[model samples]
Target: MYAHAKEVAEGMLGEANVKIASQNMGGEDFAFYAQKAAGAMFWIGVGNQTTMERVRPLHSPHFVMDESALPIGAAFHASVAIEYLNKNQWCAA
Candidate 1:
């Protein structure tokens, strides 16, 4: 991930909640965007500790989403966008 993008995310999400994942060879479509422009690919954790046993990895046939996390994810996206624009002196309008 771009350093600026990562910094923005950590600032919005809190450093404690931001984890630097080990580099992996997994193929992702976001690579295309990254090659063309500044971009980031981040994961929002949605597993509830109480029901973690029932959680399944993404793309699994039994995968289940924790709907409660929707609002949090939405807010994070908005925060990142607003912060990025502000830092760049660009209006979000």
Candidate 2:
């Protein structure tokens, strides 16, 4: 992710919640999109830690998500967008 984007995300989501993942060899389509535009892709914590035993890895048949985090994820997206736009003066356009 771009440095500015990461900074924006960290500003919106507390630094403790925003983690900088180590570089990996994983293939993601977002890499192509990012080549042409400034963008970022983030993962939200959807697993309920209290029910760790019930939680399953993504794509697993028993995979389950804590629905309560949905609103927080939504807010994060909106906050990032609004803050990025405001900083870039895009909202005034």
Q: Highest TM-score, which number?
A: 1
Clashes of each: 0, 0
Question: Can you write out model 1's per-residue Cα lDDT over 1-93, one digit (the tens) per residue?
Answer: 357656776777778887887899998898898899777887778877686668888899988888888887888778777776778785557
**Model 1 compared with the native: what TM-score?**
0.79
Our tally of clashes for model 2 stands at 0
Model 1 residue runs over 4 Å out of place are 90-93
The residue pairs found clashing in candidate 1 are none
Give the Cα lDDT of each candidate: 0.77, 0.78
lDDT digits (tens) for residues 1-93 of candidate 2: 366656766777777887877788977898898889888887788998796668797889999899898998898778777876777784334
> Which has the greatest lDDT?
2
Estimate candidate 1's alpha-carbon lDDT, on a 0 to 1 scale. Answer: 0.77
lDDT of 2: 0.78
How far off is residue 36 in model 1, in Å? 1.5
> Candidate 2: minimum summed lDDT over ten consecutive residues — where?
84-93
The residue-level lDDT of candidate 2 at 49 comes to 79
